[model samples]
Every structure is written in structure tokens, then in C-alpha cells.
Target: MDEDNIQDDIRIYTERRWLRFSSGSYFPVYVLLAASYLLILIYFTIGLFKVFPCGPDTRQWEYFYGKCYYFSLETASWMQAKARCEEKLSQLVVINNTAEQNFIQTRTRNDRYWMGLTDRDREGTWRWVDGSDYNTGFMHWKPGEPNNDGHGEDCAHVWGNGEWNDVYCTYFCYYICEKPLPIRIKGHHNRALSVP
Candidate 1:
């Protein structure tokens, strides 16, 4: 019957489409979706494995550019300030670019603060406490500054306007500390953090 022929044609068309999709177009689409999902999951998982999660001890610290910073409340000698930061599992702040310098200037606007630069090891050869090269890093020294005045100025401090000047390391001054972000290990714990 013509009706039966038409029915058979419809069934054949459906079968052709289903077979094409299942064996051809649909398989590539499924593989592409799975690959995309795997890449996305890996990207996020790498972040977790690389950075330590922020915690209580740094509850009062400022966050910038994926790092935590602590601006000291009291003044201390450069060495003392360095030791204090070490106690907190951090190092004295190292400004690496204009953006970082500007960020700290927002806090240093009206007060002098100790940074991590010192030329004590070799005069006129500035170095960051973290061992980063100063010659290749950012510098915002005040005009005619870092003169190593009185032949004993080996430490660097930021002025209210954010320019740097060489000073005696023994001078007590406000300081900044930069907390290092390391991968979190199982069973690792910092001091009890108090949230406000």
C-alpha cells in the first residue's frame, strides 16, 4: 500500500538521522564538552594547590594583588621590624612595581614607613630583603635622595608622599610586612586567628 511505503520512508529517515548523530556529530560534541570541562576544573584546582587560603592571623591584614600585607601599628628599628615580620611568617614589604608602590602610598600618605630595602651589605648596591634584584625592580626615590647621608644611612624608608630615602637602620619607624602565600599542607596551622 502507498500508506505502508510512506510509513517505511519516514522510519528510514528517522533511522538515518539518529545513526548519523550517534556515530558522527554527537560524539565530537560530547568529546569537546568533556575536554572543556576538564580544562576548567584543572585551572581552578591549580589555584587551590598553589595558594594558601587566607586565615585568622591575617584577619587585619590588607589584601592586594593576591597577597596579604600588614602595616605596623608601632615604630621599630629596621632589624626589629624585619624580625617582627618573620615572627608573623612574613617579610618586610617589597614594592615591585608602580602599582604596588601606589597601593602602599595610599597607606603611607601622611606617615613614614619602613620598607624592605637596605644597602648595608654593599653600599650603593640596594637590595630587597627577599633577595630580589633592585636594579631590575621598581624604584621611586625622592629627588637627590638615598645620598647615604652622614655615611651611615643604609636602610630605606618611604616618605609621606611615597618617595624613598636612605636612613639609618637603627631609626625607629612604622613598617610594613608582606605575607608569603604558599601551598597549604595537610595538618598545617597558624596562630589562632581572631576575627573582628
Candidate 2:
């Protein structure tokens, strides 16, 4: 009985030693394969997120659809600023999303700026001078901001923190504008439409 037990123990020890030696040879290969897979995954993920080629940096401007969108500027009164923007081959700039509002607010060194929004035509119905509805995507107002100081305050101002607060229409501040890119439709049949 003792001899048989000794032989069993020896056999188990030999098997374990062989397994360790063989597995050691393959361990490095397994590690290398896993590392290579990880590297490939990282490369593809970064490439997928890379931005497409655009034009030169316009600072606080976005060049899209053959138009230059400008932000972070100063002007006096919503009415006067709208007139000024119109004169610049543009209109009062609209903040379409939070990304745009954040971009404008970050670029601005001033305390405030005028946006193309107001309740001038109606008391509570805010509208952009471009005749667009006030879609509340990027709008961040201080608590109770549009309490419209009686009837005199119809215009809107963008604060340093990018919040819209209703101020007197005649108040002065910087403003943003959007200039449509002059379209020179080449190829007689293809007309390039200036859109967002």
C-alpha cells in the first residue's frame, strides 16, 4: 500500500512540473497577443473620433454651409445691433445649441453681449429677429431672469456665464452676427444652397 501511494505522488508531481514548464512557454505569447489586440482597438477608437478637415480657425467664428458664424461681440440695443449686423452682410447671430453658446461665452472678454432675441413684438412671446421661435436648447438664464422689468425691458443680454437676462431694449452691449457665404454656383446645373 505504501509503495503504491509513493508512486501516485510521484506521478502527480511529474504532471504538475510538466504543465508549469509548458504553460511558461505559452504565457509570453498569450500576453503579446492580448497587447496587440488592445493596441489595435485603441488606434481604431481614436481614428473614429478624429475631426474632419475644416478651414482656418476664425476664433469665435464657425465656418459652415458657406457662411461665417460670429460670436462674442458688443453692440448697443437689440434694434441697433440688428441694423449693424444687417449692414455687415449678416443678421443678429442665433445660438442654436449649448455648444455655440458656450463657445461665444468663452471667447467673450466683455461683461455682456446682445443676442438676436427679444420679446419686442409681444410681451411674453420671445422671438429671434430672424423670425425663428425661441427654441430653448442653449438658453441659460439666471433665476427669474425674464421677469421683464415691467414693459420697458424687451431685449435680451447674454451674461458672462452665458445666461440670457431681459434688459431694457435701449441698453448697449456687444452682439453676434452670421454672414452668409457668397455662393458662386459653378457647374451650370448644381446650385449650392447655403444652409445649416
Candidate 3:
């Protein structure tokens, strides 16, 4: 009888040991899975900024010659358009290279538009309306350009093929504007993006 009782006690103890061991082992696996889920959630939330996917206000801007551009302003005269852009703390669009000129031509709907390049200061010596000196060799002139026709034609206009032609300063036309992008805000975090 003594030996029988001892054997029964041994069996009970072994069964209890297995039950306790399995419970402890499975607990950690559950914990690991939960931790993995939490990590995935955190990574996804931080990776993508919360800006709207696409719209007029959330639109991305293009850059040219290290300058940022906006849609062409359709309202106002060439002079008034230039003044309006300046009032917005920007300047009339000053295209730098062939690629930029091509881009504006693509973006604009009107065939004729005003740009920063003008001959207003010296009548025949074309200069950027913003007073930036011309360094590149990307001149798109209509045939017989810079004729200084009628003596006071100091403004510049883009023709259908993206060519520049001298015109009177008072003539009105659509214009482009440029300004620095505002800082992006994402759920209390300030995000910076490289301009494309």
C-alpha cells in the first residue's frame, strides 16, 4: 500500500509539471505575436505622411533651375500680373532653361503668356523682369526678334512654340509665379519634402 501511494503521488506531480510548463510557454508566444502587430502598426503610421492623396490644394509642384513654380495666373495684365505675383511674395515666372520653358508651355492653356524676361529697362537689351541676369543660351525668339518695333516695346511674350517676342509693357497676358513651398504639417509633426 505504501509503494502504491508513492507511485500515485509521483504521477500527479508529473501531470502538474506539464500543465504548468505548457501554460508558461504559450504565454510568451502570444506576447510575441502581439508585439509584432504593435510594431507593424507603428511603422505604417509613421512611414506615410497624412497629406491628402491628391487635389488642387495638396498638389505637388515642379522645380526648374532651382526655382519652384505655380499654375499660370490667368487674371490681370502683364504689368498687373507681375505686380500680383510680387504681392504674393513671389515674382513673375522666370524660366531658366529649355526644359523649364517646355514645362510652362505644357502647363499653360493660353498660347500667349508673360514671363520674367523683358526688355523694359534698356528697350532692346532683354532682361528678366526680376532683374536676374541672363546666363543660359536658351533663347526662343520669333523670326526677326528684338526689332524694338515702335520704340517702347519692352515687355516679352511667349508665342505658340514657346518662343519669346518683344511687346509693349502695357499689354496684358497670363503670367506664371514662383514662391517657396510652405512647410508641410502632419498630425503635429512638421514634414519636409524634396521638390520634384
Candidate 4:
């Protein structure tokens, strides 16, 4: 081949070799960047799942409508029942609706249990243990009820018939405790993420 042609061929070969080397050198960097991005996405997804966990599993408590309930096997007076619930990071069960009352009735199953309602602070003015007024919500009082009978019945209890009755605060009876259920984000295959 002529001298000029030979030089041109050598130059083209050198250029191709340099291009290949440069591209090869950058391939690992691109892969590393892609890998880092994927890892970050995975981490954020895991964190999101953690923040919005699935349903709570109380083990001993029953779950219903975003709340967990515990029925005391033993009996206690109103004050003692309140203390017991507080110790467990819960409070006396507050009935908010017919569904809740039904649930409690089913759970208690003809057993008398102390409720969270009371008018001890003022006659005829009922309030929940959580300090919320109870004059406006669903009340399941029994017939001729809340007569403040004997002028001393201040605390409330659930009867076996799913009705409520006001009794003396010192009366001993079974009680129910309630707490907010942990956030549970539902997932496939019946999996749920539970928040701590």
C-alpha cells in the first residue's frame, strides 16, 4: 500500500481503539449509578411500608373497626377498672355506635361489664372517661334507666341484653378496655404491615 494510505488506515484503527476504550471505561460508572438509584428506590419503598403498616395483631385483644378491645376476665369497680385500663395504655370502652355496642354485646355474651360512661361530675350530664361529653352520642340505656336511682348511681355498666344502666361507682363488675388499632396497610397475599 502507498505511504499515505497506510498512515490513514493506522489512524482509523487508533481512533476506533480509543473510542472502544473510552466507552468501556464509562460502562462501570453507568452501572454503578443505576445500581445506586435502584437501591434508593427500594429503601424509600420499605420506609413507606413501615410508616403505613398493615392491620394490628393484639394476640390477646380483639380487633374491630380500627380499635382493639380487651375484656377483663376479673371484675373491678369503676375506678379500679379505669386504672387497670390506663396501665395497659388503654381506656374503658366507649360505645360510639350501634355496631360497637353490638360488638361489645357479642364479646361480653350476657356478662355484665363496666362501661366508660359516667355522670359523676354532674347530675344528668354524662361524659366519657376520655373527657368527651356523651350527651350527643348513641346511648343504650335500659328502660326507666339513668333515673339516678337512689340519687347515687353515677357510673354506667352494660347489661347482658346489650343495654346500659347506671350503677354506683363502687360496684364491682367485669370491664372492657379499648385502644386504637395500629395502622395496617393491606398488601397482596393477605399480608399486612403493622406499625409499632
Candidate 5:
């Protein structure tokens, strides 16, 4: 064959080979790529639905029972302790039940720690710092304690033995602060969470 005819034949053969190779081979590759993207999307969607658990974000605080507790390393008066807790957006630990009292006792290391209860306002009607009625909840007073000895004791503190005692609010003692965990709702729309 002549040179022109040979060149034309080569071109036609190359086109035919290219078409045959691409016609069926690309479908599987496309499907695989599409599937990979779909899997990635599914992974993120499921992750979004997962309710990231809430807990304390600061190393100085401890997370427990949907609340954050901070045991102050320094001693302060009852009023000072309350101010410090307020600075951290928390309040003195409030014991609501036996289990909670036990939990605080374990952390006390047999040392006194100021609690949230106090009868400062009315002497007999104790109240929490949050303004909750103390008479309505659990109490752990020491035997024959809270006698208001000499009628001076007013603020409440947890004894080394985990029993409650009313002492002078000005007495310096380490205190425990408590902050409730932010409420978390489980649903598609409420997926975003703020933990502290």
C-alpha cells in the first residue's frame, strides 16, 4: 500500500482499539468511584447522629452523674467559697441523696469541706446557695450536731467523716463546687452539643 493509505489505516486501527478498550472498562470504575463517595457520606451522616457524650472540659473539674465537681485546693470562708464558685459559674456542692453524699465523702480525704447548706437566713430554716429549701432534701448531720453551739454556728460543712455540721461561716475550709451538665437532647435537629 502507498504511504498515505498506510497512515490512514493506522489511524483507523488506533481509533477502533481505543473505542473497544474504553466502552466497557470505564463503567465499573465509575460505579466504584460513586460507591466510594456514597460510603464516605454514610460515614459522616452516622457520625453526625451520634450524641457525643457530655462531660467536664477542664482538667481541674471531675465529671460524675451528669455534673461537674471541683474540689478547691485552697481553703476559703463559706462566703469566699461561694464567691469563688460563682466566679467559675458553679455553686457549692449540694447533696441531694445518700449516693451523692457518699460520693462527696469519698473525695473528702477525711478533711472538712464546706457544703452548700446553711441556716444563715433564719437560723432554723436551712437553705442551699441556689435558694433551694434544705429541709426538703437529704441531710447528713453528725450525731447531736448542728446544735448551733453557743448559738454561733450557722454555715454548714461536711465533717471528715462525711457527716454534716454547722459551723461559723467565717471559718476557713476547703470547699467543693458543683455545676450541672448542659442538657443534651437526642434528635436529628439537636445533634450539636456543648459540653462543659
Candidate 6:
């Protein structure tokens, strides 16, 4: 071939090669990178679940809705019950919904049980021990109840009929403990990240 023709062909080839690089020819590379990251995310998510459990491993505790519950037949005053739950690395049950309330009520229908609810911080303004608001979600207080009757009732409890009432903090009663889980696996910056 002539020198000029050869030179023109080379320039055209180089331009086409540059266009290929800057155009959709690299779509596979982009797709591949995205797939790799997505796979990584999936792996870590599944690994987190497999590496840790939703609740403590024991027969006494029942797992429900990412929480663990323990019912105590032994009775104690409201304050003592609260402390007891904390001692076991849990807190008094906070019924967040009708389903959860039903669950605890079914278990404690035979006797009164202290719950993690009280207006002790401010009278007439109840709140759960775990910082959950009292008035935000499901609450099963009896009609005309929490009048702070008598000397004043600052604690909450479930009755035999599954209704709720406020009684004196010193009142002794059975108690239920609750612990929400996917517990921290330790060694991370306080974030619930799974490492495997």
C-alpha cells in the first residue's frame, strides 16, 4: 500500500479504538463492578444473621419479633422487678403493639405482672424503661384507671383478665423481662456490623 494510505488507515483505527473505550464497550466492566459490590452486600447481610442470633440461646427465653421474653413466677415489687430484669441483662416488658400485648397477656393472664411502664418521672406521663414513649403506641390501661388512686399509683401491671392498671410501686407482682437482639458482636465501633 502507498505510505499516505497506510498512515490514514492507522489514524482511523486509533480513533475507533478511543471511541470504543469512551463508549458502551465498557458496559460489562461497569456491570461487573456493580455485581461484585452487590454480592458483597448480600454476603455480609447473610453472614450477620448466621453469625449472630435474634435472641439468647436458652429454653427459658422465648424469641418473638426480634425480641426475647422471660416470665418470672416469682413475685417482686415493681422496683425490684425492674432491677431483676436489668440484672439478667434485660428490661421489663414494653408492649409495643396489640400483638405483643396479647402475647404477654396470654402468658400472664393467671396472675398480675409488672410491666416496664410507669409515670414516676412525671405523674400522668407514663413511659417505658427502655426510653420508648408510653402514649405513642399500644397501651391497655383500664377504664377510669391511673387515677393515681389513694396515696398515688406510679407503676403499671397486667391483671388476670389481661387488662392493665396502675398501682403503687411497692406492690409485689410477677414480672416479664424483654430483650431486643441481634446483639453487638463486640470489637466493632459500637455498630451492629457482622465480621466473618
lDDT of 6 at 81: 98
For candidate 6, the 10 contiguous residues with the lowest summed lDDT are 187-196
How well is each residue in 26-90 modelled by candidate 1, as lDDT tens digits?
88998999999999988876554334345544556777786678899999999999999888788
List the candidates' TM-scores in order.
0.66, 0.57, 0.60, 0.64, 0.66, 0.64
lDDT of each: 0.83, 0.70, 0.68, 0.83, 0.82, 0.81
In model 5, the runs with Cα more than 4 Å from the true position are 1-56, 183-196
lDDT of 4 by residue, 51-74 (tens): 433222345677788777889999
Residue-wise C-alpha lDDT for candidate 5, range 1-196, written one tens digit per residue: 6999999999999998888768966678889999999999988755643332223235577767877788999999999999999887788998998988888999897899998988887877788887766667788898998889976799999986899999999999999999876455666344334343
Tens-place lDDT digits, model 2, residues 105-160? 77655477887888877788888877766765457777898998775789887885
Q: Candidate 2 — which pairs collide?
A: 73-174, 73-175, 74-174, 74-175, 75-173, 75-174
Poorest 10 consecutive residues by lDDT, candidate 3: 49-58
lDDT of model 3 at residue 43? 73
Give per-candidate clash totals.
0, 6, 1, 7, 0, 0
List the pairs of residues colliding in candidate 1: none
lDDT of 2 at 125: 84
User: How do all the candidates rank in terms of lDDT, highest first?
Assistant: 1, 4, 5, 6, 2, 3
lDDT of 3 by residue, 24-134 (tens): 966788899999999998876655433322212435544554556655636556788788777656777776677887888777754777777776666567777656676
Residue 56 in model 5: lDDT? 26
Worst-scoring 10-residue span by lDDT in model 2: 49-58
| TM-score attained by model 5 | 0.66
Sort the candidates on TM-score, descending order.
Answer: 5, 1, 4, 6, 3, 2
Model with the higher TM-score, candidate 1 or 6: 1
